[model samples]
Target chain A: MNPSARQPVRATTSINGMIITVASGKGGTGKTMVAASLALSLAAAYPQQPPLYLDCDVEAPNAHLFLHPTLAEQQEVGLLIPAVDEAKCTHCGKCAEICQYHAIAVLGKKTLVFPQLCHGCGSCTALCPEGAITEVLDRMGIVERGSAAAGIAFARGVLDVGEPMAVPVIRQLKKWALPRPGQVVIRDAPPGTSCPVVETIRGSDYLLLVTEPTPFGLHDLRLAAQVAKELNIPTGVIVNRENGTYPEIDAFCEADHLPILLRIPFERAIAEGVARGKTLVDIHPEYGDRFRQMFLQIYETISHS
Target chain B: MKILLTATSPSIDSNVDPRYGRGAYFIVVDPDTMEWQAHPNPGIGASGGAGSLAAQFASNQQASSVVSGDFGPNAYNALQAAGIAMYLFGSSATVKEAIENFKAGLLESVGAPTGPGHHQH
Candidate 1:
């Protein structure tokens, strides 16, 4: 028997339910690859309670390329933008005064509202003295839900091209695809440690940070790690295309106390397969068991901590 | 008519600020009387929508014309809607020089936005 094939120690207790978010500080660091593989492995391990894969990278959702889920349901997501009623407005400049985004401005007799700049915070509407401000739904994106291989539940949010904010779309996606009890959830978060990434990883039980063993990867990983620390979430690192050339990543991880959960060595065949819309598990069937073992380890670590 | 000039400092002798949205100061002056009042720009440190905020300030100050090196789309639209003329001045010119050029009709009126809308952070 191969030493790598040895079975990993499984947790004695049930996980009940857990949300594992896969994120990266830099783009093209294999976040979707790890997320899809984990979902596939989890679904295979627990066929009775398959995992749900949510692509929260609304601005550039690409998990569907691997899972190819048949999206049978779709819902439009929007933000409520302020609409000023001129008849009731006194031109007192109160609405503009309260808007932090500067989306609304009272220019003399005209009240100008820039819908694209609005964050949908509703502060303007609530602060309008004459009750002239009303909120109207402005469509920004859409959320789609369906199932993939092994009956893995899949959902993804797609933001409209040129949309400024992706937080609203991600928020609506999570609300639309509420996971059931005892069901595992794998969220594919967007790249960068900004508001969109924060919105996706907010309520997760565990965060799996994916990165390559490169200078850019290490730089962004540090920033992403800061966000994880700030959010107080238990995080693990997965190094993709690992060639052992960059020991700095490991050193930083060891110093930061962020456990290195998995390291996927660089391979030409894997890259070619992934380029053709194949998941890591699909290219390497044995990785399915490996992913399951990683999941169990995460559960055990989180439970203990 | 009061001419609003984007300035680097609160004085007319200061160099003209190239950026209209993130201008350091706004010096409103009557070109005929040379009477002026300088106000620190409120939009200089804004995270976003600085152009719109600066435009709103210009309208609130009742400036009939604006002089800057470049005008962003939001500022251009608001100023055009408010019927305030936009004139482009060289960065080398001082606030007083830009205002003088506007009165002499030597400055070019910008028919469209000279720069992109949002600031890249």
Candidate 2:
């Protein structure tokens, strides 16, 4: 292992539960494909465990595209927005001055409000000496939870289109799928190493960074690795599309001393299966055995480390 | 005297207990002297508005100043009332470096970091 690359491992009591975060630094790295596939595999491997699938990719949540979960329950995710009572007309600009997100703006005897920027932390409401600032719930997104046909409990957040932030939606989705002992939860994280990605992988037991063998993939893998390191989480790499090219990936891993856990060879069947909205393990039973073995390898690594 | 240098960890590095929208880390430093002390961040991942979470930490420690990467207005105002000083760490710099820069008086007070389209409820 590279001396600088060797991270300090802080061991804690093994909680039979795992929060597997599937992420890629670059876009179009098939993060969702691998995340969804593993969730399905685990559900089949340990049927009694009752694994929950959480899609933390709020910006563009598409795990539902593969999981096809029925809408058993649905609700809006709301944040507290500041409301100004015009009747108590004193445009003192106190609320605007107190707003951190710039959600409130003041002009000559008039104030404008933007509900989207409001974090609902209730600072404006408290700071408003005029008693004009109050809180009103503004819908941010929706959390939908239900069971897929394959017996996986799936929960995902669909942020309202045009919404720039995804953390609120991701947080709500997590609440929907609270982790339970003896049962595992798998999270399909969003692409990129931004705030949304961090939110998704924050509480994970182990992070599985899925990457392809390309320049873009290597760059993103490195970034995601740093993020994992900063969070002090154990990380492993899954090489997707392994057949074509991987010299750069191998070199990077060798230099970083990162463990390469599993590699999925590029196959027409996998591509076709994905295009058809079917899992590779489902289309080819042989791959099912391979994924089962992969799961075993993961379990062994977690057990030892 | 306890001098709390309030900070926020990236949402991903945050943990439970500090129930903020984004994750918050409380650096309980020695007052008048900038010596390192305990970091009260439970290390649970969190996301969303940090006003309540930041308030929880400030209230508990009676913080004097907040050295954060970025803070919304709501969180900033709350910390101010709690007698906590708030500074922005928007750049790719360390908390210590930012503090040093601020003390050297090289930092400009940007007031609050929140702008349109970036605010949360």
Candidate 3:
């Protein structure tokens, strides 16, 4: 199966500035490439207003490769897991019954709490009938902050492997950035329509969905679009590596009334440059103007709508 | 002495189930009177803590020992805490044969859990 295709777009009827999140429902679809390039171009176009670029793909954050930001600030992000007080825990199995994730188990004098399976929703702790369960801080990831090229403020969360959760890290990373008027926050979201994706795109003003021209791309793009529709987030599609061969994506977008924002043609040079950790706009300076124009068009559509 | 055996089928002729918590059936037997009863493993479809729940069921059955192909960490710990001895039964062996072997003192006692519950929900 191809792990590709996903993007999120953003449009605001009330405001011009937006927290545009770029996502692909699947992985390895160049969400990072588009986010880094767009953020850099927007930063270059407006020097007075540096966009806040947040890499919310904490599980396997790769935006740092293209942005090359020297993270100056680092902070640990944690989740509160349930800690049972055996004295009060009468083994009624209430916590286990309430836990939808099966992170807790009460087995006759032995109470087992698997923190890795915990979602940190605090359901077990809050719903405890005996008040035996209490939430405890458990570190799961780290949030780093710095600045990249074109004076763009950068922040990304890195979740420790095998942590089984990324929402907490993404939430903490987003908390670090306080949105200001005229501040365009470009959040780089993780792939898939999972909890992490929902967490990354939550509270965002706009979504910039980056997709490809393959069948896998169209399929995941539809799923991502449905999510945005449900969340009432206005979205636009960016078709990467567009060679004009696949008409399926175009047809789908037209049928759904979704505008095709920017089409970056597939080029070997672009791929080679990205291999060495360079963004498209950075490698080919001419694309900077095109990306800036694309950014303006996004805001224009929002204003018009 | 009463004993609990994990089986793939209700009959003692059925092969022993490799999985402890998610096993298809559990047979409770009183060796002194050869009194036997077959019950479906309730934890078989459990999302998580199937092992723990299965151990709790075994404790409720008041079985002195449990025989299975393998035991997960949680299941093993719960069984140990419940003071129930566990024995490893060969995968190819049937429930009746495993119990007979146990009577002959041929069953190997499980000292600890075989591995983590990677297959658990």
Candidate 4:
């Protein structure tokens, strides 16, 4: 395989606007908490330059749960799929033969079109000599925008629960969530280093990978770190639930000379706050201070480099 | 067997036109004959990596292999499952060029076709 073809698109980190991603390898690692608090903390520290919070975890998007932004705008994200015209189609099995997605199948006199495999690319129709195929847009999901209580510009993408693709919805949300000049953007990415996570962090200037102090955390942290390193984005570790668990994160950072931005200790209040859909910065203001410190350290590092 | 091409497209005009679908086309080619066909994706139920419903459609076609401009993870996986091999084109060339490349044996196979019906929907 050609190396360049498989290579991921490089994200530009020189832009003054910062994109800090809150990502964890495993679920329930307080990734969302760290992401939300970072935004709130940044807003409080630089009230004039409040941060914009984007919840890219379309699978179980909960940034809205914490920020609870009033719905300002909502619209459906769509993907184009092919529909067969029986009148024009001879069921010559040509469409099925040409379909790379296997979305079109001709059986006897009838044919079935699978709506999910369609990438909306027009190769099939163009190849059809009979002109039996047409394209149609299908609503994939909804992207919502609003303002949070803290005046943080809020955006979240919710892929229809069954929809397999989150990138399209994320792409749409990102279009609206582009960092305005001088605005710090905090993105709470989906768990795991998958396509959705890649899409969430694609244009980020900096990534704040939030992992816990556990064996699983370490394992998933490695995966998350690999993703960050693959993207060549400058990243730091923010250890959440820093209780009596593995300290390997610190060792990993020290060994790699990676900066340990900040650590949020395990606390019941944080859990309760999350359960209540309340921002931890509001639930417990002290955590906000630590988050601000984390943000400042990241800034200083970026400035130095 | 005469080759057929399939893709997901939402517009009839676009299926025939080469400009839409981001220039991505699904080409099903008979490996032996190299004769092929094309279809544009309609973009429905096509989400979530390649879906199971899509595998069913491919199984129905008994497609030997699929060639396309791009494959989202879902579609990629779904196609693999249906006992169909997936080949990525060498460049953003036209469907005609892709066919030529495939016939000339210039393209590369990404992976063996995956198990069918892996997609839930």
Q: Which candidate wins on TM-score?
A: 1
Best model per lDDT:
1
Tens digit of per-residue lDDT, candidate 1, span B1-121: 7889888999989999998989999999989899999999998889988888888898898889999988987888878877889998963478887877777788888999997777431
Q: In candidate 4, which residue ranges exceed 4 Å CA deviation?
A: A1-16, A92-94, B1-117
Write the residue-wise lDDT of candidate 3 on A1-305 in tens digits: 01121122343222235678998886777899999998888777777777889999888888888888989999988888899999988888778777766567776675678676677789888888899998998899899998888788889999997776788888899898655666788999999988899989888767888899999999999999999998888788999889888999999999988888888888899889989998988789988888887777776655554
Clash totals, every prediction: 0, 21, 14, 61
Candidate 1 scores an fnat of 0.47
Each model's TM-score?
A: 0.95, 0.67, 0.80, 0.68
Models ranked on TM-score: 1, 3, 4, 2
What does the interface RMSD come to for each candidate?
2.0, 9.8, 3.8, 7.4
lDDT of 4 by residue, A132-228 (tens): 8788888889988878866788889888966767888888899966767767788899999888898888877678877788888888888888888
Docking class of 4: incorrect
Q: Which ten residues in a row have the lowest lDDT in candidate 4 chain A?
A: A1-10
Q: What TM-score does model 3 score on chain A?
A: 0.89
Residue A90 displacement (Å), model 1: 2.6
Q: Scoring model 1 with DockQ, what do you get? A: 0.57
Structure candidate 1, residue pairs in collision? none
Which sections of candidate 3 miss by over 4 Å? A1-15, A85-92, A121-133, B1-89, B93-121
